[model samples]
Target: MEFDELQDLARGVRQKYAAREHENYGRTWSREEIMLGFLGDVGDLAKLVQGKEGVRPREDLDEAFAHELADCLWSVMTLADSYGVDLEEAFVSTMTELNGVLDET
Candidate 1:
């Protein structure tokens, strides 16, 4: 799927999670909470990467890695939405800047 399509899907899932969070905890997660969750997901992805690289012992590394990546993506999209940031543009701009830096070396 394209970037926009993926972002839309992420938003839909985030909305459902918001509803679930409200029903269970009386409120949806705050941005800081979302960032914390993203950190946790990043930790999980790190372990999965280690496993994939034969440095850690984890079962189902491939599937878990994919899920963790999706989880991270969801958190990023949700955070960007919360802050009214244009994530796609930011990503492209950041990448372009990084590439320029690399080319100057």
Candidate 2:
């Protein structure tokens, strides 16, 4: 899928979570709360990475790692949407700048 399509799918999932949060907690998560949740996802991904390296043993580590990475991507896409940033553009620009810097060296 294209980036826009993926981002739309992410937004759909994020809306579902907002509805669940409202039902459970009387309000959806704030931006800060979302960031905190993203941090938790990152921590999980880190542990999964450790498992992949055999530093932390885990059953089904590959599956867990893929899931965690997806979660992190969802968080990043959601955060970018919330902040009104065009992630695709930013990513391309950043990569171009990095390549330019590398070429200069």
Candidate 3:
């Protein structure tokens, strides 16, 4: 799917989570709190990468690795949405800049 479609899906998932949080905890997560959650997911993703590379011994490695990657992607998309970032534009611009710098080196 396109990035915009993925972003929409991420928003829907965020809404579901927000509703669940409100129901259970009486409040939804703040943007900063969501960013912290994203960081936690990043940590999990790192460990999964290690496991996938055989650098770590984790049970249920393959499935857990894939799930962690998806979690990280969701967190990124959600964060970008929360911040009103145009990820596609940002990604392309950033890559272009990086490639320009690399070419000069």
Candidate 4:
């Protein structure tokens, strides 16, 4: 999706959460909500990987994990938007700089 569309989606999701803030688990998320969501999703990701030995070896993703990952991405995009950063450009520049550093090393 385009940046504009992603921004719209972020707005919609934020609005949805706002509408049910006090009802659903007593959540009244603000802009910091995005950061908290991102951190929570990251923790979930770590949890999923932490017990690889005990967990069954499977390629299929657990539904909740997928949802958490999507949530993480959405929050990240929102954060990027808040900072006026175009992720596409930053991503490219970061990779390019890494490559240059690698070549130098």
TM per prediction: 0.92, 0.97, 0.91, 0.65
Q: What is the C-alpha lDDT of each candidate?
A: 0.92, 0.96, 0.91, 0.74
Q: How close is candidate 2 to the true structure, as a TM-score?
A: 0.97
The count of residue-pair clashes in candidate 4 stands at 0
- Residue 25, candidate 1: how far off, in angstroms? 0.9
Q: Please report how far candidate 1 places residue 27 from its true position, in Å.
A: 0.8
Name the best candidate (by lDDT). Answer: 2
Top model number, TM-score: 2
Q: Which residue runs does candidate 2 get wrong by more than 4 Å?
A: none
For residues 3-102, could you state the per-residue lDDT of candidate 4 as single tens digits?
6687788868867877798688686766687688789888877665543444644454466557767777788877887778888689789999999999
Q: State each candidate's clash count.
A: 0, 0, 0, 0
The digit string of per-residue lDDT tens for model 3 on 1-105 reads 988898889999999999999999999999999999989998988888888888997789988988888998898888888899988899999999999999999
* Model 4 ranges off by over 4 Å: 1-12, 18-28, 51-62
The better candidate by TM-score, 2 or 3, is 2
Q: Can you list the residue pairs that collide in candidate 2?
A: none
**Which is better, 1 or 4, measured by TM-score?**
1
lDDT of 2 at 62: 91
Better of 2 and 3 by lDDT: 2
